[model samples]
Target: MSTLDQDLASQIERLRAEGCEIIRSEKVSGASRDGRGELEIVLQFLRSGDELVVARLDRLGRDTRDVLNIIHECESRGAFVTVLDPHVTTRGEMGHVILTVLGMVAQMERRFIKERQKDGIERAKASGRYLGGKRRIDRHVVRELLAQGQSVAAAARTLGCSRMQIYRIIGEAPPAV
Candidate 1:
């Protein structure tokens, strides 16, 4: 088998010996530093029948509600999480308390960061320095693609942009024949 498979096998064996039950699930969504890579990793762990271990709580989830829900679901299934960093585990009362505090702190940090970013953006805009991001595909081109009977998804794929962006441009475009 592949090296990753072998390592996963070893991890499963270790968890079984620790008297821990593992059940993986994929009903989750989140963002990551690499944009869309978090979904892939979460899917991988979910497919492996593993408890989805992480070195820290933030490594497992992005938002407080999402994190708590995942933890609750995992626990309800007789599985437990073992966070290595900050040494938090969601298997007992103290662990639950610590996890709760950490989750709240993470959410607060996210809110603070968002507020700071908004203030910076407003300052930049006031100074006429906020040019926003580059326009990947022109609005006229997006309109033409839609006029050619292309669906939003297809037009976005053709233009190498998001469906939301396609919709935005299309909304600004004049009525297509």
Candidate 2:
């Protein structure tokens, strides 16, 4: 098995020891940095009296507001969130408060990451290492496509992009796609 599978196995073991039963597991392939998996599994699948388990609280979200919203949604449905690492469960007032603080810290950490990325980008731009990113699709090509009797939506599809992107490249407002 892959290392990721092994780690997940260990986390599941810990949760199982806490009297938690696994119903379904989803391995989200998307960046899922936005808690899509958590939302889909916890909000959509689980019912009242169900518990959503995660290896870590941060795994649920990257922002404090998002984390709180998810927890609130679960609580409203009578479902609880259980974290395995530090073994915190949102079944109590104290745990909810602690998770709130941790969520804020996670949000702060995310802000720091974005700030550091922006600084690095600025440095790279100054050193000419970045050229504002290259456009794989050309504006002239979009105009040409439009000139060829193609609709804005068609041009966007041909370019493997969105109509808004095509409109931006073509420098004009587009009809609804």
Winning candidate number (TM-score): 2
What are the lDDT scores of the predictions, listed in order? 0.69, 0.77
For 88-160, candidate 2 gives per-residue lDDT tens digits of: 7898889998898888887788779889999999999999898787887887788789889999999988889
Question: Which lDDT value does model 2 have at 33?
Answer: 43
Error of 2 at 128 (Å): 1.5
Among the numbered candidates, top lDDT falls to 2
- The local distance difference test score of model 1 is 0.69
Report lDDT (Cα) of residue 144, candidate 2: 86
Candidate 1 residues 1-177, lDDT tens each?
Answer: 997567556655654665656433232334232344544455445532345565457656767786787777667656676776687787678988888888888888878988999999999999999999887788878878888999999999998888998878766747557
In model 2, state the lDDT of residue 25: 49
Clashes of 2: 0
**Model 1 stretches with alpha carbons more than 4 Å out:** 1-51, 143-154, 160-164, 173-177
